[model samples]
Target chain A: MDSSKVKVVTCIAPVNIAVIKYWGKSDENLIIPINDSLSGTLSMDFMCAKTTIIASPELQENTFWLNGKEQSFNNKRLTNCLQEVKRLASKSLPHLNWKFSIKSENNFPTAAGLASSAAGYACLVSALAKLYEIEDNVSFIARMGSGSACRSMYGGWVLWCKGSSPDGRDSIAKQIAPASHWPEMRVLILVVNDERKKYSSTDAMKRSVETSELLKYRANQIVPKMTKACIEAIQKKDFEIFAEITMKESNSIHAICQDTYPPCVYLNDTSHTVANAVHAYNEFKSSNKVAYTYDAGPNAVLYLLDSSVDEFMSVINYLFPPQDTAEYYKGLPLSSNQLSQDLKMALNIPVQEPGCLKYIIHTKIGEGPKILTDPQQHLL
Target chain B: MDSSKVKVVTCIAPVNIAVIKYWGKSDENLIIPINDSLSGTLSMDFMCAKTTIIASPELQENTFWLNGKEQSFNNKRLTNCLQEVKRLASKSLPHLNWKFSIKSENNFPTAAGLASSAAGYACLVSALAKLYEIEDNVSFIARMGSGSACRSMYGGWVLWCKGSSPDGRDSIAKQIAPASHWPEMRVLILVVNDERKKYSSTDAMKRSVETSELLKYRANQIVPKMTKACIEAIQKKDFEIFAEITMKESNSIHAICQDTYPPCVYLNDTSHTVANAVHAYNEFKSSNKVAYTYDAGPNAVLYLLDSSVDEFMSVINYLFPPQDTAEYYKGLPLSSNQLSQDLKMALNIPVQEPGCLKYIIHTKIGEGPKILTDPQQHLL
Candidate 1:
């Protein structure tokens, strides 16, 4: 390694929300999910995690910084991912011997069940692969960091197939479509509460595997059917099937979480309210205009078409009117259209306190990680 | 039809918290659960539903009054339960014809998942059965009104067995013991939110039965094992077994609720906090000193020994100190003792807003429905 010429790479990866959630682990050490899950990558331009890696011979040891704060590199997942990437690199760059320094930051709050870890780990693996000149798909490498991270490595529609092998090399995410394939699709993120989840997903998953019989049934029966249906729905471009499955899968994941020993309740009153509003809205129109899904936190991620965004936004506004404060809504501005009277009556949307919903993020499907050629964007 | 001699009966039924929850319905109209469930009724002195019924030929129609408002008696379940009692009475009073007036009120808010329906329906059946001079077990009659209401027909340990009979004749609540059987056991109800649950149990149960595969598995497989274990735990007076099962069962019901189509999120942040506090407390003590179970609403009913009540109360106050407002902490007053340093550190209980938990009700197991000897307690 050249002492003066530090090999550096910076990349940004978008967060992915599982329509069919990945819960439980077959091999915790390898981050192999018990069931296959499907997800859609959010726009990298809006919500994402950015990671930068610099390899220099002058560096004494590996160090990591997350969200501008120095964190321990002692995390097994992160170390394992780096080791995998380094192993891949050694095949080509045998002479490369440099200490690594990694810095990662997410646009959204971490541990809010926003899949920040997925974005973080995916960005890390991608940046590291670029730095090491590794040409292979890094989805498997990201899997070693976080199960969902593998899915985050791809954009648009993606599926992480739960493969049966002695090892998890086969459990890599495959992209179902590119952003161009679904140009009309849009995502509206309702940030209910950005507070760190009371229960860690790691702990919840471990407990569920150990104590919940329902988790076993879900992993074995429900998810397989869900995965098949979701893929088909996406392929056929059937919004109704896609939306129903998305909502059901979200509920299934949360249900198993509740089934876990001690139970995990990620969705709160506001989350339920959002889901109800979406269902009521769709029912009112007698068509699936929008679909809502929630992860391990209270925040809701909704999928809809570009054409329905304004009317749906109006529904959201009418149900959860913005507070007097300027920061009531954060994402894309709602369209000027007013909500239809029939839809309003169907939703029976209640007037919620402004603070109940923290803010909203407006974005759409986007490509996977991209290299930041501009040095100014480097986190270092 | 003795118009001048109006028969009056008044009874109080204690609230019950299911250790093994009843979630799904085989027949919604019959009020028959898909699985057997177990419960421990709270002390009537602390929390209960008081119902007064007057059978008079002067009355034009059957009527019901809940809390202070006159509710509709047109409810089919209520009508079915009354008809069952009347049919049993016809054997003796063949010519007796009288319309009944019922006034029911819960010590706590109804529809808050406090088992108000259980207590209300149980009280109703018991009162009507007495007036009709029916000596048979009225638990089955109550079951016709609410599946869990059957469990409320008993005190201390109770089990609502889901029978194989299609007619629901065999489905009835069986009391395992009286309150005196577990004198040391105490219940502390942490009312997380008194507001009515957004999703009613009836609606959620219907949805779960229709859409949740996990619920099907749970009813057919998981619940039988749970029912056996809970009964054995109660019989053995094993707090550890009872506590663990209670927590797991509550989680399972909520899980199925989440698994239900569109999902129902009953537990809130405050509910999670209380459960966390309980778990941390138990782990700290190296024994199961307390167990927490939540219903379809956010309230938490904790089961613990009488000896642990003072210490736990101290911990609760320390964790959730009431605000300056007078109404913050309503139920039982805590002991003067401060929480132990070790316990506080172990719980790591977060400081919560005053209104997050409405109040706390201190009670224990009590006897089944008891007729009020004093007419002064009657509302009408």
Candidate 2:
């Protein structure tokens, strides 16, 4: 085995925003929710995690940098993720023995509720799998880090099994549809300011563990039904069904967050602006077809048909002139009139009498995660 | 039965903010939610809708004014409420007859979560009941206008019933605990900037009408349990239980809103701020428990115990410091260190600092709807 040669493995995974949200976790230890949720993965280059793992003798300790912040290497979750990847990697490359250093960051914003970590860890696991040529399943590895990270393993539509497996070994994300299955679908990512959340995902989950009971009911009744709906929607390429499920599931997850005693963290107004903007655009769009879903943060990941691109762009330009619009729109609900009123006053980046998404991508359906061997380049 | 020597009787009702939320519609047409929701009649100095009911034999039309804009008099729901009130009034005053004219205005700094109309109609019924000297209970008349607004008929801690009646006739607002019941209880009304809601309460109700199965589930499962919890909390004057129920119910209603097919509106950062502010206060003042709940709009109605007012004040002053602390706490999620970072960059307002709430009220509790025979001056 050529395992002794310096080994560097990198993995990439996309984020998934629950349409049927997983807001409250009943069992924090296992990351078991009280409800079953439905979510859709965004088909964009921006919303994902890219990770690099190096097993080297020179590095004396297991250390890391996340999004460039040299964070405490002691986080149990990160440790768990690293351990899982190494164990799997070791199975295939047993001769490689050394200290490991992993660096991870999200292409998308982290923890405003969109599931960056899910994608981040998923990619982390997958990337290591690729780097070491591990035979262990990717979902199995990602699950050890975060519950929903496993869902990030697939591209189009994925489902996380709230499997009854006591240790959560069987609970993993399964792809319901491949990205090639729906080539016409489009997702518009609105990075609502990259503010770090008040309560980290872990803290909020811990709160839900103690307070919410509806969460328990949700995990049981609603989630099961949502999973089935997700399968049926993507199979038929039914946007209406997919969108409806996506929105409802996310809402439900947010609801659980709201209901979780002492309350859980959620996306703010600017985040809400994304929801309203998407809603207005969908209403006014010719197909009335766009769908929106959010992760833990306020950023909105909207999916639409290609025909509505121009209209989506026009509406976004009108609603969010990009700078202060994100500020004004953050504290208020998006009204059709507010767009015009906002345009009248916004001079920072040109009236943006017609605005633009920070950057718009004309992406079609997508495949699962892919490694980027180069820097300063879009995925080819 | 000379309905009045004067041709018309004019009246207005202040919109009540739910310190404890009334969420989930048990009877959609009736606007009844599952729990026995609780609220404060706010200081009413500013947040009020004025309505005048004029009777004239020569009048040829009926009209309604919302913030000076004329609305079509023919909406079915409005008609249902008006007719219901008149029917009740006529039963008491058999010969009182004249074409009725109504004018209304909301002194709200923000658009009502559309709770204004609920208050207006409830007040319309209340004022008319007094003017016409109706024999039927005000509760009965209030119900005709808006099921929940009926609770506003009386000040202090009010409750609206989500009873099991097919015709929705039994659903009425009742006083479980008055403001006077707990003289030390205080409500801090955090008025987020007033912008019209993206979805009107009317449109939201329609969405709930068409797509919300969870609305039904809530009414059947969650609300009933919560209603009982609310009653017990009020009876015992237990702030912890009261706060728990208030917040839970609010989230439940919001959850149903999420379940709506097209989805619905929500609070932004400022709203999130009010919530996080209360939470931060709770964290600092573990003994001086203050809890908050939001209705349909972004306005935060927080419940504070008389015993812990000072701690709440200090926390409010600190988290939302009079000038920039070391954070940005104002926009949303007041509990986060990032907010602290933002607060560091911005000016923070202390509680002792002027202009925190639109205006703080020192009143303890007040009685149900009352008429001012001498209208020289009135806060209500």
Candidate 3:
């Protein structure tokens, strides 16, 4: 990548959730996953990130900004992504001359489990691709940002190739089916707050690769099987297989995390509370209509059918009702004072007075990208 | 239960090496192994142990004898095994009033990965069963001694039940199809000389249980499927699947050991050198007729067909020669030392200047138990 010489390029992108889940990587530097992974891109309306890049003589080095605050972009892993994207863009736009500056921000919580970087990088690459108009296209550029980000260049159900190509050019993401293919597939974003990361995904993955034979097995057996099921579920619009695969793969990943030395401390009590409730609800009904997956944070992303919205919300409402409902919900959603008073009382989590969940949005599935002409919008 | 009983019975039994390996334990304390681990009971002709139990009113305290020398049996785990066996015998025959003096010795090294204890315990239980004519049966008696010892009672080919029963009474070892059933199965043991164990099998297994998700996957997925194949292969005289499963499971066990924190080291260079040769031979050939499995020690037991003895021997014959092989065969035997001077010079191993391997015992599979009661022997 030419360190000097750049103009203005901007992009907007949406987050993605792994449907099959990618727990282990084969090549750390190359970011080649052990097996093919399937993911669902979030809608532009709810979760998105915007990124802009500028070139000038002032910058002695590349600088990064998130939500207008200067942030370190010196991390080799992140820098690798930037350098690759720049490499591709500069190859074609050879005469371009200027130092580069990057500004990006996630609309949602920065440190949250939601894949803000997937969106952030997707937007960054798309903007550069547009500015450079290089032959490699958005996906070719997106692949440099993050393996999953390539999928964000497309809308709806996207499949990232667990590509065998050494260069990773062919490992770019492509749409399996459009978002409209299963728009009724809804995700109830469960927000569980936590602090910053203790282990970066790269470091954690490396640890797992070195120390976990279970990871090797997953890479060889479980993930491949799950990826197939996920793709088939999307294509056939089969929510049953979709839900089963999603839930199992998530559990498998969390299990791998737990299998690590000194283990990953990603989840919290609230997350477990939400998970247990969902599990209870599903097990009681004897149906696989809903499934939940969580990421590096405590928050969960619950995939439910359009038909189960009322029942799901009822469970949530029972757990976290308005402040005035305390008298009726005696045995549930106990406060700290009440919990101390009654040990037998079960926890409903978040112990909300009101609006205690951070926030809950009931949203349906949608496409990956959207163009917001008005740049100064309501975002982080 | 009586710690003050001077009539303590001590037995030093040899451990059995599985021709068909056992990997997972269904019940921990009961030593109920998941699959039937098959093995041969090497003759007391080459190596055997002598144990005598004397119970009298004159004795004062309970003690143990290892290799004819008095030793402390205060170690909880060892004491527990002895106590349990004694309790079972005493419970069965309350009328036998005798204070027992116990003495034990092994003609060969004990617990150096030849499964000396498994053999010794089984033999101990056998002798005890004979002494009291305990109607509870020798299998039951052996189970009380050690989990694997139960299998040691009749050693042609045995299956240690991964007993589902909670009390574990049903977990006694059973004769699958004795060595007589498959006389064509040949075992060439390659013992490697690494005096110190990096970790005991007990510790390694516990580590695997706690730290290894790989073990769970193997136990849950691989073993179950492999076990069925093994039983079928044995019944149908199918050598291919039998060999493949044995080697894979052994390798998987070793892999789990390597994945342990501070890792459990198993194979030394000598061990790997033999393994590499075997692997290369198998890979180079159009058909793989031979397979190898190792126990806690570096000893590699090569299982092959009777017809392939010459080829197998030729390939590994260099490891054991035509002379007094037993003297050259140190506690841990490396194959390269048995090679001709020319071949030994070409190879880098524990290859000394002269013949070093124990004379190869070329034998076919045979029956388990024989009762020879000559009048003179019986009187003695």
Candidate 4:
């Protein structure tokens, strides 16, 4: 290979929201979680992180640009990811001894509490792996950048095993089911309007590991059974079981957040109102029609079947009326419908003021990261 | 005694906020708690429930009035409390057969989330017992009315023991320390302004008992040690340990609420902001100068020594400034002091918009029920 030759790779990766949330780390350096967690990889057609990597001997040094702005390469996690990827690449590709330039951006609002970092890192690692001709799994290398990034490497349902090995070689994400297995599944992301400073997940989870005893108990006792049940639910296509487990696990994870010393409060008033609305909706249906899960912020991620989408969207509109209904929903189209008086009575939650949720994203389970063979998609 | 002769008694009772919370019930009917709890009784001068009880043969039937409004006597807990008080009185005197009338009112805002019911029940029971000339402990009678009411029947530090027996006869509030034991201790109740419908504590705790596994774990494993540590801290006047335990227990109880299926959300955004401010204030001081405990509402009850009051008040005013500073504080007066530049910089929380808090009440440890001798003080 010519030493001065430039190689470029571009990829888009999905964002995964954990049903059985990953909180504390058993090993901070290796990004080994204290508990097994599972998540649904969202469709990249609606939301994704796109990245391009350029490697050339002509480049001066390694540099990173996030969302059109230059960010320092001096970050510990960023440096670790680059070094690990290079180490794995140098074993087979001698021409990999070159400076790299990376550019990444999220299609959706980065400040909306979506797991942009997970998708961003997953995309970067996938693109880098392809550039160096490393065909093996790069999820572990993504895990070094962001713990949840490992789960984003797979499609459909992914489970991150909390392996016992100290070296963390066995602690990798595995695909529980492909997106095709649950084609009826749909997701609605309710982006809450908040202006408060967000608590950093890295710092929050670190404190939880050091201080929260409930988190420890949850890791040791509760999550193993929950992860198994979730897997079974997904395999059997049991929406009711999946919904209950999803909501309960979400609450349990937030319970651990609250139990942490000084307590990390992620769910705000609007988040609570959204949760109450979900419970009320389920109670009205007399069955599990929809499930809600919150990550490290107030935004709510709802899981439901395609059959329930029209009715549930009506209910969501009735309870939390948007300021501009035309611009309220993004991604997949939703049919507008009127809510019945019985449902209005059943979901007795007071109608929230207009625009409690900034907007909602309609998407579904989707494939893993995709390499863009067209040079037109490249960022640099 | 003449059958038409009327006997009247008027009494005032303090409100107690638990440092270690009592969440679930072992015996729902008997009102026996699943775990022990500790609290501090706020001074009656600032906030209390005054009740007047009258007994006479001329009365046609039993009746109750709360806050000058006629309330139905068919309420289960109220009827149970009345019947129990009569049974105890009948054992000592036959004149107790006369019909009884009760009137009660709280000085503070009923909708502000202060423990008004606790104070109301305690005052009613105390006044009723005096009218019937029953001198024995009436705290157990108050417990029949409300779980936390038992704690309000004592002054200063109070502990409600979660008795092991099925009968709940041993489940009673004991005075851990009197008001004079720690005169320097002060309380500031920050009433958060909210328009949302409040979750009923009775329903919330019942669901928590049935659905929350963490509540069971916390009741059985956590409260005992916490109660002991809090008592030791109070006895030694160790404000640091006391503050740490108070804040942790508050967070733990809220954690159990979140862990409940469907999850009960009691703390609002303003409530969370107040908690963050408390933590930030402590972090700035490099010591635990203040502690905050929230009941089942948005209101925050803070505990601190008198020496730290001026500095902490300045911090609170800076973070959550009032719309009208002149009308911001109620009860005891606070010395207005400017926040130092260093302290403000150290407490790096963003200043909140004006009037996040409806008002603040400054009070201290005070005696329990007080019998008023003057006829002018009677509610009737």
Which prediction has the highest TM-score against the true structure?
4
Candidate 3 Cα outliers beyond 4 Å, as residue runs = A1-9, A54-63, A72-79, A90-95, A135-137, A193-197, A320-358, A374-380, B1-32, B35-217, B220-380
How close to the true structure is residue A7 of candidate 2, measured as C-alpha lDDT? Answer: 57
Q: Candidates' DockQ values? A: 0.67, 0.42, 0.05, 0.77
Please say which candidate is ahead in TM-score: 1 or 3: 1
Tell how far residue B270 is off in model 3, in angstroms.
45
Cα distance off (Å), candidate 2, residue A284: 2.0
- Over the true interface, candidate 3 deviates by an RMSD, in Å, of 13.1
lDDT of each: 0.83, 0.61, 0.61, 0.89
Quick one: best DockQ, which candidate? Answer: 4
lDDT of 3 by residue, B155-175 (tens): 466666566677666767666
iRMS per model, in Å, is 1.4, 2.0, 13.1, 0.8
Q: Write model 4 residue lDDT over A261-323, tens digit each, in one string.
A: 889999988898888888988998899999999999999999999999999998888888889
Better of 2 and 4 by TM-score: 4
Candidate 3 lDDT over A1-380, as tens digits, reads 43344356666788888777766666666677766777788777767788777666655777778888998876665677656666766664643444567788777767655677678778877765665555564574465556677778887888887788887666768889988888677777766544423457767777777755567787886677678878888899888778877866766665566445324536554565566566656665677767888776667888887777666666666565444443322211222222121211332233333433554555666676554445464232
Best by lDDT: 4
lDDT of 2 at A124: 73
Off by over 4 Å in 2: A1-27, A30-75, A78-116, A127-133, A154-156, A194-197, A322-365, A369-380, B1-15, B23-35, B40-119, B127-134, B196-198, B305-362, B371-380
Q: Model 1, stretches more than 4 Å misplaced?
A: A1-11, A48-75, A89-94, A97-113, A127-134, A194-198, A318-345, A372-380, B1-12, B46-74, B90-113, B194-197, B323-336, B372-380
Q: Model 1: per-residue lDDT, tens digit, A137-159?
A: 77988999988999989888999
